[model samples]
Each structure stands twice: as C-alpha cells, then as structure tokens.
Target: MTKLNLLLVIALLGSALVLVRTSYEGRRLFAALDRAKNEQRQLDIDYKRLDAERQAQATHLRVEQVAREKLQMRTATPAVTQYVGDRPHAASGVAR
Candidate 1:
C-alpha cells in the first residue's frame, strides 16, 4: 500500500507539472498573438496614411505644377510649333 501511494504521488506531480507548462505556453502564445495584431494595426494605419499622401500627390493640379515648375514645361502654341512636310521614304517608297 505504501508503494502504491508513492506511485500515485509521482503521477500527480507529473500531471501538475504538465498542466503548468502548458498554461505557461498558452499565455506566451496569447501574448505573441496580441503583439502581432498590434503590429498589423500600426502597419495598416501607415499604409492608409501613405495612400492618402499618394492620392494627394497624384492630383492633376499637382502634376501640372510639378511639370511647369520642375521640368520647365509649357503649353504648346502655334507660334512655337513646327511642322514638317512628309517626304517619300527611300527604302519603302512610302510617305508614312
């Protein structure tokens, strides 16, 4: 009967240790998941902010402003326009 009691105590201690280890693992996994979710939320917010900035930058007025200011571009006018008369190509005898 004493040997049986010792065996039972050993089994009970092993079970308690397994339970504790699994509970600790569960808490660790839950904390990792929470951190991942917070990171995802922050990334989503940053993406939205960058998307808004991109939209603002891609507006027609912004494009025109950049073109004129940075590229020194201007609207075409007849005074500055040049036209070339088509001549027959020597290789294909074509005017296109």
Candidate 2:
C-alpha cells in the first residue's frame, strides 16, 4: 500500500509539472500572438498611407507637375514642332 501511494504521488507530481509547463507555454504563445497582431495592424496602416500617397502621385496634375519640373518638359506646339517627309531614295531615286 505504501508503494502504491508513493507511485501515485510521483505520478501526480509529474502531471502537475506538465500542467505548469503547458500553461506557461500557452501564455508565451498568447503574448507572441498579441505582438504579431499589433505588428500586422501597424503594417496595415503603413500600407494604407503608402497607397494613398501613391494615388496622390498618380494624379494627372501631379504627373504633369513632376514631368515639367523634373524633366524640363513642355507641351508640343506648332511653333516648336518639325515635320519630315519621305523623299526619293538616294541611289534608286524612288519614293517606295
């Protein structure tokens, strides 16, 4: 009977240790999950802000502004335009 009681106590201690370890692991995992969720929220906010900025940059006015300012570009006007016409070939003298 004494041996049986000792065995039961040993089993109970082992199970208690396992329970404590499982509970601790569960809490650690929960904290990690919470941190991951917070990080996801921050990433989502950043993505939305960047998307809005991209949309703003893609506007027609913004594109034209960047083009003219950065590229020193201007709209085509007839005064500044040139046209070329096909002429006869040098050797064959034909406008094929």
Candidate 3:
C-alpha cells in the first residue's frame, strides 16, 4: 500500500510537470503569434505609405516638376525642331 501511494504521488507530479510545460509553451506560442501580427500590421502600413509616395511621384505634374527643377530639362520649341522629310522618298532596290 505504501509503494502504491508512492507510485500515485510520482504519477501526479509527472502530470503536473507536463501541464506546466504545456502551459508555458502555449504562452510562448501566443506571444510569438502576437509579435508576428504586430509586425504584419506595421508592414502593411509601410506598404501603404510607400504606395502613396509612389503614386505621388508618378503623377505627371510631379514628374514634370522634378524634370524641370532637378534635371534642368526643357521641352523643345517648334522653332528648334528640324523636320527632315515631308514627302516620301522612292525606295532604293535593296529589298530581300
């Protein structure tokens, strides 16, 4: 009877240990999941911000402003344009 009591006590202690370890692992898993969710949320916000910035940069007015101010570029005037040919020339005999 004493040996049976001892065996019962050992089994109960082992079960308690298993329960504690399981609870610890559960809390750790929940913490990791929460951290991942927070990171995902932050990434989503960053992605939206970057997307908005890209849209602003891709606007025609913004592009033109950057080109004029940063690149010092200008549009060609009609007077500066040289038209080479108004009439079609006869094709030379160089066809395959």
**Where does candidate 3 clash, by residue pair?**
none
**What is the per-residue lDDT of model 2 for residues 5-86, given as tens digits with 9 covering 90 to 100?**
9999999999999999999999999999999999999999999999999999999999999999999999999998999999
Question: Candidate 2: minimum summed lDDT over ten consecutive residues — where?
Answer: 87-96
Candidate 2 residue-wise lDDT at 7:
100
- TM-scores for all candidates: the values are 0.85, 0.87, 0.78
What is the per-residue lDDT of model 1 for residues 1-96, given as tens digits with 9 covering 90 to 100? Answer: 999999999999999999999999999999999999999999999999999999999999999999999999998999999999999957966667
lDDT per prediction?
A: 0.98, 0.97, 0.96
Is candidate 1 or 3 superior in TM-score? 1
Comparison by lDDT, 1 against 3, better one: 1
Deviation in Å, model 3, residue 53 alpha carbon? 1.3
Instruction: Compare the candidates by lDDT and give the number of the best one.
Output: 1
Per model, state how many residue pairs clash.
0, 0, 0
RMSD of each: 3.8, 2.9, 3.1
Alpha-carbon runs more than 4 Å astray in model 1: 89-96
> What C-alpha lDDT does candidate 3 achieve relative to the native structure?
0.96
